[model samples]
Target chain A: MTVTPDQVLDCSGLACPMPILKTKKAIDSLQIGQILKMTATDPGSKSDIDAWTKKTGHELISYEQAGARYIFYIKKTK
Target chain B: MGETSKRLAIIAAHGSLDAAYPPFILATAAVAMEMECAIFFTFFGLEILKKGYADKLKIAPIGNPAMPVSIPNIVGVLPGMTSMATGMMNGWMRKAHVAKVSELLNIALESGVRFIGCQMTMDVMGYKKEDLIDGIEIGGAASFLEFAGENAITMAF
Candidate 1:
């Protein structure tokens, strides 16, 4: 099954906090129930984003590895 | 997976650039995790709150155990060695895309991390209110300890 995202954020070539920082900023613009697709090369972003989503009450619908990129789809729950 | 602690308090006691990053990074991460955070900068650490001081903060290689290479105490005393070491570390962080100290400070502030400057330290060190950055609350040990007392965790760095 394919889940389409309402928004996409590219965070390649960034490190640790940048990906999480950018994700936090990007998610604020999303409406409730809207899905944000984030792509990053930083391996740490996986757990960082996971932790962020859990804390913020966002839904982490998907975390997939496609080739060299790690992709995350988050839904704003609040 | 239960509700994480909603508050965190940190005491930053060192002034070196290398030492400074941990508190800011942790504060930022805490805020992102929806934790209310406060950072109290005391003594040398208060230098981070002074206007235009973050960029000037340097890691003195002399007697620093974490330096990549150890130099003799006499050689470490030479002029320009601190600057050279600072430059090397800055360049490495830049190449690795680590956020600069100033940038991290801005992020932490914007994320609503409470920035507090120790009043007793400032008075003893002869620092005035205008010497620090805006949005900093001048606080005494009791005030910061109050915040710490209410929080689940208080860490010192």
Candidate 2:
């Protein structure tokens, strides 16, 4: 719960591919094991991020919801 | 799980505003998921590749009952209904902060989504290669299928 991110991406208000797209870009800029904290308003990010992490071999460290926002902590694995 | 990156082959056959978003959106998202993606734009779908057309593409409400505002078919057939419906849809997309189709195109191209303008369709439609945005390949059905044949996941929109 106290983990800090290497980068924070604010994808609030963006829809569909934007959230996942921005999350991927942010994760790409990190070295292995670095964490990206991305926040988005798109409700679809839950499934999308899960699928993306599964497919891309990235690690979904954790995620939580705050009101209307979905926040994810993703770690770069490759 | 595999050594080769999976491929996605998409056939985009419709040119309406509603039709245009799927291929690019899916393509970009697929690319983000580390899939090798290509979209073959054919028939009316070519409208999406035309310069300056994506943002201006209109959705005709005349035959679309799914119009968010639910205008009756009679009113939908009226002269201004297409633009009205398109405007309302654009408003909704904007209100939800959806990226414009044009922006999606940029993302697709930048994310390495291969855009294949169907050469046969292009010849039939009389569209020159110069009319499309840069970094696109014009190929025929055989070429598209060649890529699609390589363990690629294919879809249409």
Candidate 3:
């Protein structure tokens, strides 16, 4: 499948809380309805992003595992 | 849901001297985000909310394998050492511009963050309402469970 990006956030090698923190910052800078593509290597990224999106009312478009990294596509809801 | 507000509850259970930082840091962060935050102090965690105990608490190195070798492992065993260490640590934090426990508590209060003391813990510790600091609401686990319900983020520190 083809992936189109609106914004890219590389959060590899970051620890717990930081990945979420950076993601929030990235999403905050974008306009509503704009997409955010985040790449993280933290093992907790998958669950953290999942929980964060659920809690923050954001939409998770897709999540893919690439080699040792995890990538996510998200849309700003608020 | 049409609400834009964030609500969180931090369960402070570790009565360790240094363990107080988790709830304080997280609560302060919540306040920074303009979120409604609450800290429920249970068991030994209530020590931090005491009038003078917050300034008198210390991080015990006993049973802590991660402690540096220069610091004596038995420092916690010595009487008054905990208070001394707590004082020193507080001073260092001040020098480093880190927020004080009292400051954080005040900030939480000012930001409208609720502070709840665990009734069961207070009973176990032989403390009364007057034994704790002012402005604390006494409640049981069920109360906190209710407060943590309905999508509110809950964390045990």
Candidate 4:
């Protein structure tokens, strides 16, 4: 499925905990059911974001890797 | 707001620059995971809460063999070794895009991660509430345990 995000956040060049922190802050501004497209350069973000999605009950529509950037399509739930 | 069921409780017992990152990083990450988080600063860890202390924290290389640059114990004990070690680590962190400890501390506070200063430690150290950054609640072990409660993942740094 092609998921279009309602908002985009760039966490490039930030290390662990920062991408997650910024992602949380950005997602907080979006409405429930809206999607956030987050791009991160940290390699650890793959597992971290998945774990965050699982713990927070947010939906991870899809994730892609473009060169050094890891892109995530996240949908806010509740 | 109805939050998640998980929680994180951190006991920060060290104040050295190398030892300071874990609690703040874990607490903030736990918050982003939608978990309740609190950090209790005791003993040396209380130094992290002092206003303007982050910039001055030092990493002693003598005891730390894993420092990016290995130094002989004798050499590491020389004057200014701690300063040099701290500077080198700071440079590495900057290159790695890691946020400063001060910045992480602010993120934790702004994100609602609870910070509890040990009241007895403050008393022993002659630290007044004004000596610490604002928004931290002063309390003792019992107070922190009360906040940690049950079912929270507990860790110490």
lDDT tens digits by residue: candidate 2, A1-78: 788999999999889989999888898889999999999889999999999999998999999999999999999998
Candidate 1, position A63, lDDT: 89
Backbone clashes in model 2, listed as residue pairs: none
- Best-matching candidate per DockQ: 2
> Rank order by lDDT, top first?
4, 2, 1, 3
**DockQ category of candidate 3:** incorrect
lDDT of 1 at B42: 97
Pairs that collide, model 1: none
Docking class of 2: high
Candidate 4 residue spans exceeding 4 A from truth: B1-5
**What's the lDDT for residue B102 in model 1?**
92
lDDT, candidates in the order shown: 0.88, 0.90, 0.77, 0.91
lDDT by residue for model 4 (A33-60), tens: 9999999999999999999888888899
State the lDDT at A34 in candidate 1: 91
Q: How well is candidate 3 docked (DockQ)?
A: 0.04
Clashes of each: 0, 0, 0, 0
Model 1 agreement with the true structure over B83-107: per-residue lDDT tens digits: 9889888888888888888999999
lDDT of 1 at A48: 90
**Each prediction's DockQ?**
0.71, 0.91, 0.04, 0.89
TM-score of chain A of each: 0.94, 0.97, 0.94, 0.95
Give the least accurate 10-residue stretch of model 1 chain B, judged by summed lDDT: B64-73
Model 2 root-mean-square deviation: 1.6
RMSD of each: 1.6, 1.6, 7.9, 2.5
